[model samples]
Target: MELLNQFYANEKVKQTLVNFITDGRLPHAVLLEGEPGVGKNHFARLIAASSLCSGEKKPCGQCRNCRLVLQDTHPDVMLLSPDGADKPYSVHALRELILSCYVLPNDGDQKFYILRNVHEMSEQAQNTLLKIIEEPPPHVFFILTCQNHARILPTILSRVVTLTLWPCPVEICAQALKERNPDTDEEECLRLAKQSGGNIGRALSVLQDEHLSRIVKNAQEAAQLICDGKEFELLCLLNGYNRQKDDFLLFLGELRQIFVEALRQKYGASDKNFLPGAMLNRISALQTMRILDIIDKVSGEAAQNVSISLSGAHLCSALQQTLRG
Candidate 1:
């Protein structure tokens, strides 16, 4: 039942929501849309608690209603998610949720239904839920959390008040990391924050990934090898990556970041590139973009059930063309 006092970034979102809650103008249906690690779920819970809490200060953590919501024992709050090997919400499940909305609140004056991964709901399921929201019960409120809003139906999107969360700022992410893990080194926090692209969850996860340094080193080596026209060595390295999909992906990401820094360097912009000056000087901006295009194409192809060696071959051939171009 902690107040919405500390979302690391997105002050505009935080303040607008607080205004909605305090002004008693909160919408009946809210769509919290954002990337996976952007805290949409966390905000949904805070909104739910605020809606249900019966205190002098809404969601006063010590209030009985607030405590119940925080404990997840509140009878009026319903949490619906994909169930039983199903990746998407089923029509039957949506019907059940719709029916439950009609039931009287157990203790609180309001009932809140928090749906996770609403983007996974099928079109029919969304249509079914649409009917309920169209004329929602006076006591019921719906909060839907989704990573992609495009997957949701336009009609449903029209009904809900959509709030999109973007990546947190680097400083805010670093501060949040420091607050969460006091013993973590500040330098490491800043490095992770910078690498996370403003994603607090991603920054926190970077701290847990021990192989990050190895990936960075490998990326640097890959750049040097490609620039030196060591095709055989590069092919051998690519073959080695065939068995480690996650590491390969991380390596590719590091390679992209390095080239991005190189692009900044080319434009005389300050960057945190650790690549050797010789390697940076070897690749022009056009060459870098071409290489990145190859990587992106390979990444998309990898999504299919293709053989890893085939992808490795493609990568080697593409690198040759990029280097020559």
Candidate 2:
């Protein structure tokens, strides 16, 4: 597939894979670990495509094999994911995958199995997988993708070639978004890229989420209310958000970003300051630090399944106390 070329970030990882594919020295088992939306799954597919492509250039996008892999209809490629609504791969499913691997390739000289969220596999399941990866058929290849590699067994780690994917620069991510959707404005792209914290998937998600603009406006309004020490108005404003847990978090996150942007502005480093200038001028460096501390504390508490209303109340009261001083 052309996905490797299109991968927005991690040039080192991309170059490493390109060398492996070009030299026909790709490992029998590969593990790709990265944050969510860092494109681990797409990178894995590109590796599989390179292995299965029939053209002189590995993964020539126009080749039949590349097309099959792109369309996810390749008989020789198996995608093993969480089955039976379980956190880990079932032992039965692991065994079936092992048995299936031994069968001859249906259409190519080699077969590829792409495992998603492989870290969720139980120790027993990984052990079963380890046995095959240790002594796999010459033509069989395995690609594993996960968010965390520490959870994987050491034995499994030792047997596989591991690669870490990092978030791309915002500029690269913005360029990618522009290429994919030419009509999106540069301002929106930069906003999403900045807010997403370099995650291409998240940047794209922000663009697609219709409620985001409303969320940002509400966050800015809420920030103003808190900073102005409007206690009753702040509570009432937060009341609108307290019913939905996700929306509450989203609101708080946007509010938190405004403080972050304020700190950036104080340092003369901010280009995308979303918070109003009047509010920004009111916040001193020390005040910004204090507010950030409050945000961190509230965020930690919220993670413990605290009620959204209580969290909102605490956040508003704390902001009042801090900003009023």
Candidate 3:
């Protein structure tokens, strides 16, 4: 259970899962829902390992089954995902997987299928999976991970046990980061933990990726510029991403997170400062809400293959107008 112990926060969910494993009452179909970096995939793997472990303590980590699962070489544990960049599970692939479910396990009495980001499956593909999930073979288990469960069909959802993962406290997350990267500076780890709002995966990404770190830094600067009503500076900053749609999307996501923190602070719901106290004083809750709306609209447009230059310009103009109002 080393992996489970390392999974930060969500004590209740972890206990429930431990109970299910101990009682041999683990469900046939499970859906893990959470935003990116919340550890849904890691949780899914934990369930898979726990179910397939041959050792006394479930998921002993050193057991043969546990080792195989950790290495992603388990014969009975299959990892499935969408076909391509568009990230849609094809009906043909779903059919093949469904057919394989009836086959006996390769190494153990039970088999597990870990489906990553199942929310990407199209309606047709989902319907094709419905029958198998509704009445899966006794030896087969389906573990699905998704950022949002709302995109899944209600019928499919009805057949599965849904578990949601959440961010841990900042101190816990920072400590985890420190443990994972002992050579890194403690102050840097805490800064990343705060920036990511206690999401370990996100903080780790920023710590490891210089480009991503730069994006976050730029987004913070943009937020400050918006609060200062420096339209020209903000526009110049945004125009730097005129040809980088992917980077622009990431920038918008980080920008949106700052506004969300701002909104939370305005309502006295959060004390973690994403912006300076002076900047927060300059913007009202209503203005933060409007900026969030603008970011959402621009983000959607940017995702739809809109020209990055135009989207950047729109974001700058809309943010300035909202702040002025």
Candidate 4:
């Protein structure tokens, strides 16, 4: 992402940013909602840099403020996210930020406070944010990023201008990857972009790393185990996930891909296996619908910052429900 430019998929977002910079029509808060790895953070950083840059258009990418922003030393810009657990934005962090908002800017005409992954914000933090959005200082601008916009209180949503970011187009993702790393192979870039479903960051991740083939292989194996009625193998897979908790999402994604593949296989197979045990009876069409439902429900639950164990239990139940059709 070229900060000064290169935003794709939503013109309103660019227009919103434009309004803030040129016309000084800045909102107290703006909610940027989008899918994972879709460059929401990059957009947030660009907006912050634009706010701090003293040039006519601000984020000239050639100005001193731009340099400072690139160096991650911009005084007027503050970035905060959830702590150690990689989840839960505590009320404590928000409280500190809200207090700091009153101090005003140091080196520029405005102040930018970015709170990423705010879906994890504590209830108290959300309330505090509601107050800030409702009655913020003139030069202050808040950008809150979350995978699900609904996780923010309705009151908070009402107070701010909302900009929803969509995933970058696959072609755009390929172009970006090529620009970012000229050494990258075109075929691999296109493949990753397609596989990533418009999330260029994730596309890059999938493309650059060769180690994930093992994860994909394991996922395929797990899917076969489910189809084969191998309960012990399923247990082992779950245990393996528990041991390496950091890749929990990746593991879940893999399982989901397997489910999707199973659904796709229904197109050709005369008698497809949708799920194990109780779920083995569902029709292919019903199985597909159920898979979508499960994905949606699980994803919705994740936005609430629920525990993986609880989520997995629910997910397993959902799978059982789908197959029993």
| Top candidate, metric TM-score | 3
Collision pairs in model 3: none
- Model 4 segments more than 4 A misplaced: 84-89, 216-249, 257-285, 292-324
lDDT (CA) per prediction: 0.78, 0.80, 0.89, 0.69
TM-scores for all predictions? 0.79, 0.75, 0.93, 0.74
Query: Quick one: how many clashes does candidate 4 have?
Result: 2
Better of 1 and 3 by TM-score: 3
lDDT of 3 by residue, 1-325 (tens): 7778878998988998999999999999999998899998778888999988888888788898888898888899988777555443788778888999999998879999899888888889899989899999999999998899999999999999999998777788889999999999899888888888888899999999999999999999999999999988998999999889999999999999988988987887775664578989999999989999999999999999899989988988898778776
In model 3, what lDDT does residue 182 have? 100
How does residue 21 of candidate 2 score in lDDT? 82
Cα misplacement distance, residue 158 of candidate 4 (Å): 0.7
> What are the runs in model 2 whose C-alpha is more than 4 Å off?
1-3, 83-88, 212-238, 249-306, 314-325
The CA lDDT at 291 in model 2 is 87
Local accuracy of candidate 2 as per-residue lDDT tens digits, 159-182:
999999976777777777787779
Worst window of 10 by summed lDDT in candidate 3? 80-89
Error of 2 at 269 (Å): 14
lDDT-better candidate, 1 vs 4:
1
lDDT of candidate model 3 versus the reference:
0.89
**Which 10 successive residues of model 1 have the least lDDT summed?**
267-276
Candidate 1 Cα outliers beyond 4 Å, as residue runs: 83-88, 209-237, 245-297, 319-325
Clashes of 3: 0
